[model samples]
Target: MTGKLTAQPGKREELADILLQAAEGMKDNADCELYLVNVSEDDPDAIWVMELWRSAEAHTNSLKDPAAIALIQQARPLIAAIEPVKLRPVGGKGF
Candidate 1:
């Protein structure tokens, strides 16, 4: 999954930090193949996240994880807008 998140004004860096923390935590989940957080060069408020899961179920299950839920709660208030895009991997270098 790929998502574009816009932070609430000056909260972009704060949101990115939380996401990076989430990325570190994701390392423990075997089903979580990848979790990458990126920033847009031109847009200070833009945060892009790329995630790859072993299965759709794994992705769904991650939302229920306590740590993930906590991170979500932290990020929620900082988010001004979010555009989520789902993608199926045909072939990828990371996977």
Candidate 2:
């Protein structure tokens, strides 16, 4: 899964920090293969997150986690918009 998140005008750095913290907690979930957060070079307020899960179910269940839920709550206020894209990994070197 991948997502593009636009932060409120001056909240980009705060949003990015929250996402990085969330990624650290995701390490506890073995099914969460990869969780990456990237800041756009052209647009400071634009953030991108990439996630690789063992299954769709795993991704869904992650939302139920207390840590994940808390992070979501924290991020919600700073996010202006969130656009998600689902993906299937046919074959990839790291995946």
Candidate 3:
């Protein structure tokens, strides 16, 4: 999963905390390989995430998990928008 999320103005810290909590919670999931990348230096309110899982099934299953759902709920208010993009890796150096 590749996604971008924009937080409400002045709510970056709160949004980051929610994301951090979510990351910690996902640590126990065997199929989860999560990457939370804060790519917007000039705009602290924007964040990007890249997630890789064992399979699409695993990713789908995680969405319904209680902890994941809770994180989404907690982040809803602070999030201005969420845009997700899915992709397949073909080849890369050291990928």
- Local accuracy by lDDT, each model: 0.96, 0.94, 0.82
Tell me which residue pairs clash in candidate 1: none
Collision pairs in model 3: none
Across residues 1-95, which tens digit of lDDT does each residue of candidate 3 receive?
A: 88888999888888888888877877889888665656578877888878878799998898898888988898999999899999886657634
Clashing residue pairs, candidate 2?
none
Off by over 4 Å in 2: none
In the range 13-82, model 2's lDDT, one tens digit per residue, is 9999999999999988999999999999999899999999999999999999988899999999999999
Better of 1 and 3 by TM-score: 1
User: Of models 2 and 3, which has the larger TM-score?
Assistant: 2
* Two-way lDDT contest, 1 vs 2, winner: 1
Q: What is the TM-score of candidate 3?
A: 0.85
For model 1, the stretches where C-alpha displacement exceeds 4 angstroms are: none
